[model samples]
Target: MIATYSGDTMGTSWSLQAVAARLSVVRGVQAALDRIVAQMSQWERESDLSRFNRAAPGAWHAIPNEFADVVDAALMIRRASDGAFDPCLGALTERWGFGARGSVDRVPQHADNGGDNRQIDFDPQNRRIRRSVDAFLDLSGIAKGYGVDLAAEWLLANGVRHFLLEVGGELRAEGIRPDGQPWWVDTEVPPSSSLAPWRMALHDSSAATSGNYRRGFTVDGRRYSHSFDPRTGQPIVNGVSSVTVLHRSCMIADGWATALTVLGPQAAISLADAQKLAVCVIVGDREYISRPWRDMLG
Candidate 1:
């Protein structure tokens, strides 16, 4: 029998299922996830991330090892995606009313276009980070994926080999189910569609999906998506509806999903192909699959 447990974290729910059933193990997993939220949640005022966002500029601040790891991943992806995905868009996110502080009445002026990820400095040796500009660091795009990974790690350490771990919509599956089958997941068809959902099997891999379909608002007949282009400080008007990425690390899959969504379908497809990443991009009624992702599906 697979043991299952779930709770709230990072403004979303997290669920875990393992082959080993133990209350102690479940509590430990919950604790591990809670620690991640305490350290990385931008929505929580007392979170380490929030404190870092409000810290004085030009001074290096010590960070938790896990936090530093996520930052390092974000910076690497930022370079790989050519700024399509950025963690330094906190100011722009807030200006667009997508921040922890909530929404505002009108679009704020885009003065500085926020700052680039290059402005932030990371010292992996000491797990320290410092920001040169006034930009607020937001890890919402990638932190939850780390949370999922942490939960999975805890289960593995507890000797639970076959499991599926999910935080919010991000997920990672390891080994096989009790019935000796791979964990299967379904990709939702874009909103307002009558089409059947696409299905994929996960084996020792992670998947994350990013889209503007459910989280945008209309202002004066103009639609503004929650996703913003870090380079322009403006909402992306790209034709792509959603992007799903599969990787060995949930954190990388999560960040790449958002990055590819921002890049739109064509550019996203090209990058996914070049990187040999498994990705599925949905544009309008059409779906595009990268070579790696196609192999996975087959």
Candidate 2:
């Protein structure tokens, strides 16, 4: 029998389903996620990430292995996406009123990217990071995915072979259900929209969805998305509602979902095709699915 458990982390909720695993494993799983938040959360003033962000320019600070892993993946995706998935955009995000400072009705004024101030050099081999300027590193795009993966890792190490794990809306599935069926999940669509949910059967795979509808504020009838274009240092004006990405690593899926969302529909399709990413992009009810998405669904 599988036991279900859930708690909170990363300013969101986490849930798990384990087949033939001890209930006490929940404590270990929770601890694993807590470790990630302790090191990565900018919301926590004392978190390693927060301390690093507040340090002097050119100062190198030691980071935990968990933080380094996310940074490595983020830097790889940033290069692969040509800065569309920049982890170094925390300052821009805050300028757009989406970072640790919280939301605002009026958009904040800032020059575009301010030329090199939003840059970071991470040394994963030494588990350290250096800021070229006063840069804030934000991982809102991918840290939740890492928490999901780490929780699943804890479960696997504790003898759980069959399970599905989730933090916020990001998901990772392993093995099959007790009935020998893959975990079936549906991608989230904007509320009150005429969009159909995209469903998939997941086993040993992960999925993450990024949508403009999740966070933002409306001013003068214009809905400002929390999604900031790192290239422009402004909130993206793209018409995209959401992008869902499927991959073996939830962290990559999460980052790619955000990257593709910033790239918008047509551009995202091209990049998804080139990367062989299984992705579905929704723009005001117009659904665009890549070849990999179609192939994976079939």
Candidate 3:
């Protein structure tokens, strides 16, 4: 018997279901996701990588496997984006008032002390993390997509051949929907009365959107977005409203969305082409394009 549970998890609506001969497996998967969240949330704070606001210097100590996994993903995106997308933006993120705490009236511009590329010491053998710089990290870039992927894996492992998993709007689809159609989701846009939402379909793929339009603030006549440029320690003022990436894994899609959001359309497109990655970026006024979006959907 398959069972389903729908509730708020990680500050967003989520549902999990599974197809096992016995009903208990679905419940188990839900419990598993919940447990992972509980553990990751704590690791996000105590880990040295999250050094925003109050993260003490010299606290770059080894953490557990969960923290290691997030660091691993962040490092991947950092290298992929040539340091455009980084985990070390925690201090910069909070400096611009985008962390667990809110804004400050003023912040110092980032000092280019060659501190950006400070290597994080992660002993995979020991599953620990160490950092040489006084940096802060935020897994917000990759965590949701990683969580969604984990849930999808859990369901598929339990014989759920058809399902959709979403966390904080990052999504993944596997097999088929119950109705026997490819799982489709709209490319979400700001709700303007004059504009209609863009839609896309998915089949055994993942998609994620990162945007300043959805989450941001203004202070002293300056606008700030949640997407922090780890390189500059400043909010990106790019005209792009949103960038969505489609990829094989929800984790990669989520990370690339943030990376390309920072990169904006032109540069992002260049990098995506160079890497042969599938991506779509939506700028303000609904102008958008993805070179391989049509082909990827097919």
Candidate 4:
């Protein structure tokens, strides 16, 4: 029998399913997830990430291994996406009222643009980070995906081979179910459409979807997406509704999804082609799938 456990976390929810039916294992998994939230949550003032955000400029702050790993992934993606996906948009996120400070009625005159990846330095040897500039770091786009990966690793370490783990909308699946069926997941259809949901069978891989439909606000009849473009210090005005990425690591998939969403359909497709990444981008009424992603679907 497949055992399941789920609870609220990271301002959202997390779910885990494993082949072994053990309450002890489930409890261990929950504890592990809780630790991740305590370390990485932007909503939590005492989180490791929060402390790093508030750290003095040019001062190196020692971070937990997991936190460092997530940062490393974010930095790599920031370069790969050509700065399209940035973790340094914390100040911008707050200025736009998307941060822990809450939303505002209108956009601010001067959005604080401090958190560019170039301003931050990581010393992997010591698992510490320092910022050259006074910038706030926000890992919302990629932290949850890393959380999912952590949970998956915990399960594997506990000898649970067949499992599906999800933190927020980011997820990873492996092996087969108890009944020998492949693990399946459904993609969210655009809210404006009445079409059936898209489904995919996952096996030893991770998938993450990033979209502006569910997380945004309208101001004076103008809608602003939570996905911000670091260069403009403003929410993206792209036509793409959502972008999903499939990769060996959920962290990479999650970061890529956010980066590709900011890039829109045309540019995203080009980057996907160049990087040979498996991607599916939803632009208005149409869906664009990369050749690598289409093969994954088949």
Candidate 5:
């Protein structure tokens, strides 16, 4: 028989559906997720990421293996996405009221890539890093997806091969259902929209969506997106509403989702096409699908 477990972590909810679930399943998975949170959560004052954030400039600080791995992935995506998927925006994160402080009183300025890009250097061999300037390294964009992957690893290593794992709406699946069907999930939809539902099958794959509507505050009738452009030091105002990415790794999916959302429609789609990424970008009342996405569906 299949069993299900659910709980909260990293400011979001997580759930797992596995075969022959034991009492240890929840504990095991929770432990795995806690590992990531303790290493990467900027919310935790003593997390490895938090410590690194406060590290004196030019002084390299050692990071845990997992934390280093995620930073490596983030930096790769940052380069691939032309710095659209940055991790050194913790300062902007707080400025826009989405950081460890929870909220702030500041009006967001217009978009311009002229702001400081915050220079952070990673030493992969030593599993350490240093920064040239003081900036918060926020993994909020991608850590949740890594959390989901951690949960999946727990389930797979514990001999539960067939399962579906979800954290904060990002998801990963492996093997097959007891009935041998793929785990099906729907992409996020805006509130009060009558758009037709889009579903995807997760069979050893993952999906992550980034949307402007997910978080932000409205001021004087103007709405802001939680997804900020690290290059601009402000929440992106591009007309793109949301972007969903499918990949084998949940972390990559999460990072690409944010990057594509920041790139807006035309440019995002162009980059997705160049990267051969399976992406769906929603802008205004229209949907833009990449070639890879169509291939994935078929």
Candidate 6:
């Protein structure tokens, strides 16, 4: 049987019927996820993408298609949202004391609409991106969701027909669990008012939530979100607390959730309607709202 824990850091469970093979598969999947994380992590100064961050302007280097693909997805979301979400907002994030080493209680001016991410440009076709200023690429917004998708792929390839894979808070499920129920999750925030969680039966889909509660800092006696607005180059200060997105692909759901959260309730609702993206938003007061498509849940 798979060793299960009530409060494991991963917050997940797996049945032990196919115990031996499942462990092997999970290990392989974990290894693969680690590799992808290393390659994409902005924190690792030695990572390939990190090297690009340090390169001089106009320099082009041959990058792996895998890396290209991940950044390409990020860039697509950046463009698709008209700059509502940005991966190139690393410069401001650090200056605001959200980076490797940050000075607590000091709110930098660039934390608002005066950051350096405006100079970064991504070119999808050439697999080359440029930054006129020094900056970092923070994948905190979408990495876990991408990892979930990767894990699901690994499980499916192993002939596992029924499973739920979650890394961080991004999750994907297929078929039914050992109890013969579609694997599900709750979309409620923890009692702390500091953590918003999600619940859903992910039989053939992926779900992800983005929130401002866990990753915020007090600045000038007010709280500011880590989510940056690409269009204005500032952190989102809206009242909407969290957003959960569901879609066929975990990556899309993950990216869109963050984007929609930054957009807040009204704008997110409008975008959900326009793009037909299935979404749910929980305002600061605990009232949950969702796209009309979520009416299918009834």
lDDT of each residue in 1-298, candidate 6, tens digit only: 2222111122233222222244466575666566665667666677776787678765556566666666778878877887777777666677766665554686665434444434556567777666665445766677667766776777678886676666666777777767667776776463446544545676789877886676778867888777767666666877767787888888888888888878878888888878788787777556455555567567
Clashes of each: 0, 0, 2, 1, 0, 6
Across 1-298, the per-residue lDDT of candidate 5 in tens digits comes to 7898998888888888887778788998889899998999989998988888887788888888888889999999999998898888877777678888886555756343444647778999999988867456988888888888877887888898988888888989998888888988898866645576598888999999887787888887887778887776777888777788999999999989988888889898899999999999887768899999989777
> Model 4, stretches more than 4 Å misplaced?
112-118
lDDT of each: 0.84, 0.86, 0.69, 0.83, 0.84, 0.67
Model 6 lDDT at residue 43: 66
Report the C-alpha lDDT of model 3 over 1-298, residue by residue, as the tens digit: 3345565666677765433334565565566567556545423454344332254455445665656777788898889898888766655556566665666666456563434454565577777666555555567788778778777777777767776667778878777656667776887675542345657778889888886777667668876777866676667877777777888888888888889888878898888877777777777665455567646656
Better of 1 and 2 by lDDT: 2
Better of 2 and 5 by lDDT: 2
RMSD (Cα, Å) of candidate 2? 1.3
What's the C-alpha lDDT at position 44 in model 5? 94
Off by over 4 Å in 1: 112-118
TM-score of each: 0.95, 0.96, 0.83, 0.94, 0.95, 0.85
Where model 3 places Cα greater than 4 Å from the true spot, the runs are 1-4, 16-29, 42-62, 103-118, 192-196
RMSD (Cα, Å) of model 6? 3.7
Which of the numbered candidates is closest to the native, going by highest TM-score? 2
Candidate 6 displacement at residue 50 in angstroms:
1.7
Give the lDDT ranking, best first: 2, 5, 1, 4, 3, 6
Candidate of highest lDDT: 2
